[model samples]
Target: MPEIRFRPKYISFDCYGTLIHFQMREAVEPFLIGRLSPDELDRFIAVFRTYRFDEILEYAPYDQVLESSYRRTCRRFGLDAEAAAIEAITTAVLNWGPHPDVPGPLAKMAEHFPLVILSNSDDRHLAASVPRLGAPFHAVFSAEQAGAYKPRLQAFEYMFNALDAAPEDFLHISSHQRYDIIPAYDLGIRNKVYLDRGYDPELPPYEYFSARTLADVNTALGI
Candidate 1:
């Protein structure tokens, strides 16, 4: 385990994969069932995940991201893509519950340091998810408000400006390196925690603390 000291005004999180399971794969599994074999479905899911990441990097709206990623993944899999399927996946994201370990540790940590969420979700969508976190947030920001998505420097700047804090004032925590850590590091956020959920292989060159669960995060903070 990596040793880390938590000393920040706010501990910011990437909500989807870090705090919540981010059921994108689960949401689409039923639709893909019987349409493709298990092995084929795995490949399709992988491609869809990559396409979704690529779409967000272009600074498009989240809805376009879901639609294009669905179409591209369908093309890759030789399946027909429909707009309703994309809409269903997007709706599923908003309906996702927090990870089983999230609510308790998050509530405990909130008592020590203010908690903040920087999610790639719209205001209306996040309205449903944030309360399920079971902790009062100091702030919750989204790509819809920022006009850009994660891995973009502009999104981080929006959060920093909104909170009136410097990069050093936050201990940024996230599960995805490409989506969160690399950009955050480049933007001068040094105290970062990689909440490793196996979204991608760990790249130690980023020099971030790693935790397997939110309980691990609380322990790392000495709480």
Candidate 2:
């Protein structure tokens, strides 16, 4: 069990991969459709994922990141690089809904504390996804609004300024170490929860509270 400490004014989250199914690979898989061998397709998918993260680090718009990742991945795989392929992947991201466990615990948590989303998504994309979480968010801060993406201190700074809340005032929860926990820790956020969804390995030195699922998160909070 993870140790829980410090009740927060708000519980901030990373919506996409943390709460939502974020079916980027599932969306891209059909597009491959025998263009590449199974092993090659998997390798392409991995490359696309890496490129997406790398793209975000460059401070470009989210759509550009998605498009460039698709183009680059296709080029690497010797596949036909087309605009439609990128569009399909971007569309899939906007249309994704929360994971099965997300709505219940998120809604329950919202009843007790304010819930906020700090996602590396644009406003247009997040608009479709946030409602699917089945919870009333106190605020949804996006990368477009921040003029930067996550893992950047500026994004969190924008969130804190918008909410008029300090770093110590909220419990930040996310599944991505690069995007959420590492940066949150650097910003002096003491109440951090690592929702381990297997995207990254745990680094104990970050000193975050860990939960296997949203249910574990709720239990840790004594909800």
Candidate 3:
């Protein structure tokens, strides 16, 4: 892990998984349990994850993205794609809680820095999810507002434009390296935190420090 070298103008976060619970697996498992056996279930899950990643390459309504991802993933695994199942999983996003360790430390971090969220969610959905983080945010930006989604450069460009801030001005944090870290780094944001929520493995030359949890930010940043 590297040290947090500069005090940033803003501390930006990716809401899902990094701060919010991001229980996509929990929300979708009901649709697959009886359909696949223990062996097939594992491959089904991997494919689903892959499909979800594929779904974000273009801008679309978040609900449509979820439905299309699920439908494509299901078809790949030789399963029926039910619209109601997709609806259930999409709706479940609103009720996810914070990671158990999130609230207290994040609230403390907010005291020392201006907090912001750059989420790949719809406006109405983020309204319900953001409050669950238990800290007041300086700004909460959504894909619905930005008209783009992450792993795509336009998404961050939209966010940068909205915050009226440049890449180097903030310390961006996220659990998904593919979604946030690579894009942020390419855009000239050097100060970054890779929160380890186990979505992807870390690699060097990625140009960011690592933290196991939100509480570690205090010590890592010398706050």
Q: Which candidate has the top score in lDDT? A: 2
Candidate 1 accuracy as TM-score: 0.95
- The parts of candidate 1 lying over 4 Å away from their true place are none
- Ranked by lDDT, the better of candidates 2 and 3 is 2
lDDT of 1: 0.88
Clashes of 2: 0
Candidate 1 lDDT over 1-223, as tens digits, reads: 5556658998999988888778888888888889999999999989998998888876766777888999999998889996667778878877889989899999999999989999887787679889998999999999999988998899999999999999999999999999899999899899999988889899888879888898987887788
Candidate 3 segments whose C-alpha is farther than 4 A from its true place: none
Instruction: Show model 2 residue runs off by greater than 4 Å.
Output: none
Give the TM-scores of the predictions, in the order they appear: 0.95, 0.95, 0.96
**Residue 87 accuracy (lDDT) in model 2:** 80
Model 3 global lDDT (CA atoms, 0 to 1): 0.87
Rank the candidate models, highest lDDT first: 2, 1, 3
Each candidate: what lDDT?
Answer: 0.88, 0.89, 0.87
lDDT by residue (1-223, candidate 2, tens digit) is 5647678999999988899887887988888977888998889888998888888875777888899888888888888877677788778887788888899989999999999999999999888888899999999999999988889899999999999999999899999998999999999999899888888899889989888889898898899
Question: Of the pair 2 and 3, which is ahead by TM-score?
Answer: 3
